[model samples]
Target: MRKIIWLASYPKSGNTWMRVLLTNYLRNSATPVDINKLEGGPIASARLWFDEWVGVEAAELDDNVIERLRPGVYRCMAGETHDTLYMKVHDAWGRTDRGEALFPADVTAGVVYIVRNPLDMAMSCAHHWGVDIDTAAESMCDPTFATSRSLGGLSDQLRQSMLSWSGHVQSWLDESGLPVHVVRYEDLLAAPAATFGGVVRFCGLPFDAARVGKAVAFSDFSELQRQEREKGFRERSLRAPGSFFRRGQAGAWREELPPELVNRLIAAHGEMMKRFGYTTHQGGNDNVD
Candidate 1:
């Protein structure tokens, strides 16, 4: 069986940019993969297809029954796709109780985990949803946040999904035997060719400099934001464009983030944030450039 490559991430953590990069790269190549509609819902489309069956006609069942149905469903779903299936999954690594069984057991590959600085991620999330920065920050820290799987219902679910990009990214880093390429969003934004060239190599596809250029051209935040502003792409489900693409640069958070709050976030996740070369202190935001 050909490998299934899952581009996994916490929401608003640069998954869309990764998809754009991959889709752009594959479109100009002979890669056999379907650019299917990425489904979003209460239970992620991946979780629904891989773990449970839900449709217009829904059936409630016990966990054991859901477990029993997964393999057959996965086999059917995988068989429907062509050679290699590149699916985008937003669920965190620890969200599902089914362990590795939540995905196709025969998955030949793991994922390309895309990470962003939490500070930047918070700002991005705020702008995307038109929420206040503190609301966005709270969403990251609040376990009760329903949308993110990393959020705990009442307590911490793995980590607070809204504020837990470090934990989310680290989970993939710790997984062994899986080819995990950690790509930073800021790096991609800074230099598309080198960053996306790495992704192209990881996907085992022939790299074309032109394709990288095309990806960069399309992935540009300004262009995307303009398109969204003019065409109302944000309202469309299949291609919902928004301020999510706002400020793809690394340290825009410094200018946008209040000093006290920045210190708080730094204190909360400073150690792991430093791991990705982000600064929690008040200084020049030229960490990645």
Candidate 2:
């Protein structure tokens, strides 16, 4: 069977950036595929590789029936052939139904889970969704927050979205026997060559140091932001242009978030937040002096 490599993460946690990197690195992948229009593209497309709820929806006709048909959906997403398929997924496995996690017959060879700071994720999401920081903080722990890719709006959407983040991260982390390689978004940003090298090696693909370097250099926040603004690729989002890459550096929340809100996120997901190496209180510098 051909191998399937899924780039998985919580929403707003840099899955697209990883996709950009993988699309550039993978031998078979050329041109970054638009996630929204993936179904009928050159790459046999499906959202099975995405987050839990999304996989459920993609697998079933009705969103409410996601859990029932999730396994079938993942199988379909993998399609008939097993040629190496590099896919991007935002939903976390631990957060999704167990049936959903059982997809990709070879777990060890197929998963790349990226973890980012919840605080920064919250900030990025708020900017992307046009909401306040507090709402974004709460959404991190709620399973219902509608990511850019999620369909249908429910009454408890906010709560669901928030809970999903924790569930998703924990899901991938809990899988001990699988071939899951956890990548920290912070490390990827700080050291693209080394971090992405791990991804290249994991996929059994040849690592072109120069090309990988070229891709990383080209995929920087400024360049991506420029592309989004002038190229109109990301203009459709509710967020302002350039906001897509707002503060790509970690801990921006420390500088941008209000003191009270920072404390709130810390209290909410503080322990989980530290798993990614994010300090809750910004090293005792609470005052915005």
lDDT on C-alpha atoms for all candidate structures: 0.58, 0.58
Q: Report clash pairs, candidate 1.
A: 140-162, 140-163
C-alpha RMSD values across all candidates: 6.0, 5.6
Q: Residue 62 error for model 1, in Å?
A: 8.6
Model 1 Cα shift for residue 99 (angstroms): 4.4
RMSD of candidate 2 to the truth, in angstroms, is 5.6
lDDT of 2 by residue, 66-155 (tens): 434444545554565456666555544432344444344542256778888776677787777677777777777666554533255322
For residues 1-289, write the lDDT of model 1, one tens digit per residue.
4656777776777776677667656665443222232221122233435423334111344344444454455456566666666666554453234454444546536577787777767776676656788877766655335342322222111122222555556555663345688887778877878998998888888878877877677656665566556554432232223444455677677678886666666666666677777764544243443
Cα RMSD of predicted structure 1: 6.0
State which candidate has the highest lDDT.
Answer: 2
Question: Which of the numbered candidates is closest to the native, going by highest TM-score?
Answer: 2
lDDT of 2 at 176: 28
The TM-score obtained by model 1 is: 0.73
Clashes of 1: 2
